[model samples]
Target: MEQNDGLWQALDAMAGEATEYFQKARLLQERMAGITGTAVTDDGYIKVTWRDGGIDGLEINPRAMRMGSADLAETILRLSHEARADSRRQSDAVMSDLFGTQNPAGIVADKEGLQESIDMMRDVFTGAIGDSKDLIDRLQRRLRQD
Candidate 1:
């Protein structure tokens, strides 16, 4: 029937949209995988690169040898933290570019929102099940009276 044909057409269009969205997501993921962030100490004695949530590369200038071991270690740690912050900023940019929002990662990271969603779903299911149970009990009582 014509109505059936229209329904099929609508379903096909929805499927095509879903496929396009998934393809874009895949491409964005690939691009994000290639992203890297780098930072260097103020004196340029230490450089660090962060990728995929970990340190990918580190370089120490020969001038760094003039410093004591403790100083050198402290500098390295500071540079590493800077590099990690840079990486997080870059990742946020990528997420914004792909999703047209800057808070997708924040939303995913938000335990409050996640917990609220879970609680809402649980409440809905519990209410539905309770209603079904009440209906079943009434049906059983009516059948017994019959």
Candidate 2:
């Protein structure tokens, strides 16, 4: 029947799209994994390097030591926060660019049947930002005690 043929064609098209989406996402993930970078504070006393999900390196200039313990700590904390925020922002941008505003697995594949999956990702990013901010605040507070 023509209806049966049409159904198969539609399914085939969807399968192809899904495959492309996954391949692209995987490529982006791999590209992101090896990207390492550093950020420096305005005072030139603190620098932080990070890759993937953790701190890769840290450098504290001798100039910061002259600022006393508290100032030195604050400078380091601020630089760390800046580096983390910058990394997260970049990661989010990459995800957004790769997935687009409408998630391929959601709207493109099943026409809203996967809305929950999309919602879950949004929650994940929201929670990540909240957690990152909390962590930065904690670090700042702890450093201020020095």
Candidate 3:
């Protein structure tokens, strides 16, 4: 009975430690909410400003506006996705700068595929769809044969 009691006490202590850690992380996140990062498309036609949650603003080039609405919309969609990816990359860089080698609590996990989750979350957090690099590659190659 004593051994069981001790085990439960230890578990309770660990849980308390975890809770404290999470609280500190939340504080850190709150403190970081105001900082912003800018991500421009590779072509410089679109620029997106983002923070912890989603895009704060978007700017489209006049050249982009010349296209028909459907074409402009598609291009905008693609650029938005790219901007979001760049935002995530920027966010990771900032977080790494802030946290060093330690993974930020609630932002990432210490397991395989966690990086992928981080990448996905970055896009989700920015409210953008992730690029289909594979599809782009295939289309690029197929269309180039003409």
Worst 10 residues of 2 by lDDT: 1-10
- Compute each candidate's TM-score over C-alphas: 0.63, 0.64, 0.45
lDDT (Cα) of model 1? 0.78
| Candidate 2: segments with Cα more than 4 A from true spot | 103-146
Over 85-116, each residue of candidate 1 has an lDDT whose tens digit, in order, gives: 98888877877777763245766788898788
Computed on alpha carbons, the lDDT of every model, listed in order, comes to 0.78, 0.71, 0.64
Candidate 1 wrong stretches, greater than 4 Å: 1-17, 110-146
Native-to-model Cα distance after best TM-score fit, residue 12 in candidate 3, in Å: 17
How far residue 41's Cα lies from its native spot in candidate 2, in Å, is 1.5
- lDDT of each residue in 12-126, candidate 2, tens digit only: 7868977988898897778678666568977667789767777788988777677888877776677667777777777766766787775443365684557776797688556
Indicate the residue-level lDDT of 98 in model 1: 72
Model 3 ranges off by over 4 Å: 1-27, 41-43, 105-108, 112-146
Each candidate: how many clashes? 0, 0, 0
Arranged by TM-score with the best first, the candidates are: 2, 1, 3
Cα-based RMSD of candidate 3: 23.1
- Checking candidate 2 for backbone clashes, the offending pairs are none
